[model samples]
Target: MSSNQRKSFFDLSASGQKKRLKAAQDVPLPGSGSQSSSSRREEDVPDSPVPLSQPHPSSEDQALGHCPRSDELELCPSASSSDEYEIEDENNVEDSSEESSNDDDHDDDIGIREKLRNWASQYKITATALTALLHILTSHICFSSLPLDGRTLCRTPRNINTVEVEPGHYSHIGLKSTLIKLMSGVSHTINTVILHISTDGLPLFKSMPGELWPILGSIKNVCSLSKIVFPIGIYFGKKKPIDCCLFLKEFVEESIDVINNGITIEGRKFQVLIQGIICDTPARSYILGTKSHTGYSSCIRCKQEGIYDKGRMTFPSVNAPPRCHEDFLIQRDLDFQVSESLLVKIPGLDLVKNLPLDYMHAVCLGVVKKLLLTWTSGPVNKCKFPSRLVNQLYSFVLCHNLSAYCSILGFPNTI
Candidate 1:
């Protein structure tokens, strides 16, 4: 149906009210001038049975023991109490025809709900946005069958416990369960499923020292800006997790089961693969139980020791000995390995190959942002461009409409 028609349905239902009209009776009142004439007219008119198809009065009307048609009873103030029982008897009988209209109204309600569902899914509306829309419509529109809660409409869980994962920590929803839910009814075969897991520490409050270290994972095939991102686990404390192995205990156990002996989602077994574990330098060091980025043995890819230059550790060697998975598993470098990583328990997962640096963290946000800030705001040097050259470059960007390009590169309106 058209949008206008859908809106009119609500408007008509809210504004239009069914008025109950009753037959006027010639009952005499306390201040009546034509008492004899009313009695004569009542005697002249013969009483007839009320039609079955006529709308019945509600229970409240029957309990009052009188008809409340004020417009018809303008001349006669008093109503006969004898008709009260008769009205009760009429109300007791079922009106099947009246219910047909209600059935049609219910059909219309279902249609409207279906349209709203399709519209929401087509436009990819967020749960919060759709919930707000449903609330607004429920409050203003006069719909008997309209849903008030967004979760009810979306068919999601109502109560999600934050303490369901473990005690003294935050929540952890399993990856295998989430994958089963997402890949329930697929047309094509999904023999292998790839995933990218990431963990990072975020400060919750600035006034206090509350931090959250969440283990987030996403499917490689469906990971996008528009898609829903679900977390594997979250740790909430004043600081980061004290023990990284203990924090990743549940994730490692669950991932091992799925990786070793595949998951059977809806009776279809599918193999799971860890595509990568994307993380920043500090977060990677924390999760992998290695020295921090400033340490001598902080290089994740190679076995080269960092040199302390200008009061900062730096990796100047380009031809360093590359580290392999076997070396990492065996802990060949004592300086590189602080403690054993729980991620090693997962079957068929490479500690080196499956832990790749993400472009956003390692390149765009890290190197490119630092380079731009240094060139634009840092002290003047040979690397910093002169004012005339910077203005020309800015003009060239405006001429080529490269604002979006600059924004994607992690710097907006800056050459």
Candidate 2:
């Protein structure tokens, strides 16, 4: 029969019809009828291997408790059962969020401690010590009133009995009393006040031309160790005033009165005297109304004539008579001499004796530095030692185990 004319067993629903179809299928063809029934049964069964065509379990199905099996379709959980799992997951998420918040709070605490430690370490302080120091600083104990080494000098009981003087035209009255009060506890015996005046040009700005000439005064007895220079007056301008005596007129008048009539301090009379003036070369010349240090006759000690060579004026060591106050008075009419200087008018004061050589300028800077430069650099121009042999001599000194002493004298090892 043709394939289209064949009937299917599935078209009938009766059990007898299905049994007849099963028997028809079981009846073997003519060529395959020789096989035994047990062999046929074995052939009809499938091999016991894993099914390759089975669908995989999806992620959602596995989350809902489902298995990947064709015969187990009821393994998936119902909607009501899955609700409990979702609620549990939400609770776990809340727990995790709370744990993170707690961790952040702990981290914030750690960060605060770290910042405090860094702040203390920046000022070189330990944590425990810094806490104690802050407590002490904020306390109301008036620690500033406590006596310190150098700070307690003027505040001592012996120096406390002060006599306040009224303001005067030139200076504060009772100045002598205040000074004696400061020196009361000192061991040095002071019967009179010997004042030393100092003046210097202070430049106001580096690029500008203005400067200030300040006159300073200090007690001569205590000046060596405690040379405190108090400002008396300040003259400001680009150039020095033409008449310095006029600017110092009030000070001079007050000093004259103090010298003539002694000042009373704490009911005790103390005599005052103008000792001398201390200044550098330029300031000294300007104040004393003398020729500049570079002038032809610039030597204050003697009447030696200076020769101008190259760009500098050099004075030779000649045996010339020293100028005195009488000589200054006699030569006041001369064109070179300044007759109107207040220094010449001060009685009982010898200009020559009063004005001494400034050791720092004349000896240390001028002589010593010149000698060192000549020794090191071998007198390139207008230096004392014009020969290179001086440098060799210096090297020889260095070679002879005198480097230590040379270093003390400001001589470098390399040059």
Candidate 3:
């Protein structure tokens, strides 16, 4: 075994020490004159201090007294007077630290400008190519750009509230306070503001059953070109009637207050009214506290009973009720007595007149989509025209270059 692996006297037990001594008798001792024992002993001793020798100073450095001072050498006892001077020459030219820092900043600015220019050039090239490609594909490709100002980009503070009805169950932001704050902020310029609330069921995924009901509001005073919608509430999961009522409860109370007593903003008071709600048939039915659109007596305008004809509920020609708000307030056969809708509670908001049918859903999705699908590939009985005629019609529509018209119809390039 190597000497390093051998057990020391302190490490050995009483019996182990006797065994070590017997083993040591068998091993030959190192000669007295040999360096083996001296070397081993020297290995155990701490190293002695050595004199530090510095590099020789240049003639110019020596003349300038840049070499280590005598007092410095004296402070280090191990240093000799013959030790070379290691001090640097202070005469060497160099830019100031501040100047160097400024230069680095200038270089960084230049680098950033160059990168931006390159990126802009690439973007321009890409935009030009895309425009040219789109132009070739559709002759009537229209481009509309709206310039945004500080007012347009201004974001109002959001008040998010958590309501704990059950443990770990929290509600989203309170719609009443949020809407009041939003109205108060915009009351300065507008003397009167009309709000149009819209709600629709949005399926979160095509393959999943997850759904979200988002309530949106838009101001009527703003130009149609610059009109922006703000989200008031979002409910996840099944859109139950009770949940809908709960969501609109706060909003209804706030709306009544705003309509009765106008909000003051910057010393000016502005009257705010919830003019109407825009939604599809199903959502409208839910909000109006009426029967589903497919039910027997589903028509919202009239007391017409829909006939179950050809696998569909068809409403026949009937004398509809007067287009008045009070008509809807009068409870119908299917009206929910327990959970009354917010639409009926809020004053000035005409349930019948204010709740206009969304053209995008009623006309575009309901009529146009059905007609298109039928023309393209529906049952022979339902198809509007022959396959050859439908193809010819499609080609004609494509040739006409009606992108703007199609866009207005809510289906661009659908032909």
Candidate 2: deviation at residue 212, Å?
A: 1.6
Tens-place lDDT digits, model 3, residues 281-390? 88887777677777877776666667999888887776755445655666644432223676687877777778887798778888889788777777776665786786
Residue 253 in candidate 3 has what lDDT?
72
**TM value for model 3:** 0.53
Off by over 4 Å in 1: 1-142, 147-168, 222-228, 369-381, 403-415
Q: After superposition, how far is residue 407 of candidate 1 from its true place, in Å?
A: 7.1
Supply candidate 2's per-residue lDDT for 134.
43
Distance (Å) between predicted and true CA of 259, model 3? 1.5
lDDT per residue as tens, model 2, 1-415 = 3544433332335675546434644666466667975565344422232343556666565444333332332234345537877999999999999999889877765664455456665676654565565455436453332223222212224333222121111222233444655566555556787888777777789997776666677877764425665666556667665566665565566666677887765566778877888889888877777788888877777877788998998876677777777767667424345545676665556777888889888887788887777765654555556457666776777677655454344444554
TM-scores for all predictions = 0.63, 0.49, 0.53
Task: List ranges where model 2 is wrong by over 4 Å.
Answer: 1-181, 184-188, 223-225, 333-335, 379-415
Against the true structure, candidate 3 has what lDDT? 0.58
Give the C-alpha lDDT of model 1. 0.71
On residues 268-332, what C-alpha lDDT tens digit does candidate 1 reach at each position?
Answer: 89899887888888888888888998899989888899999998788999999888878768888
For model 3, give the RMSD to the true fold.
20.7
By lDDT: ranked, best first: 1, 2, 3
Write out the backbone clash pairs for model 2: none
Structural RMSD, model 2: 29.0
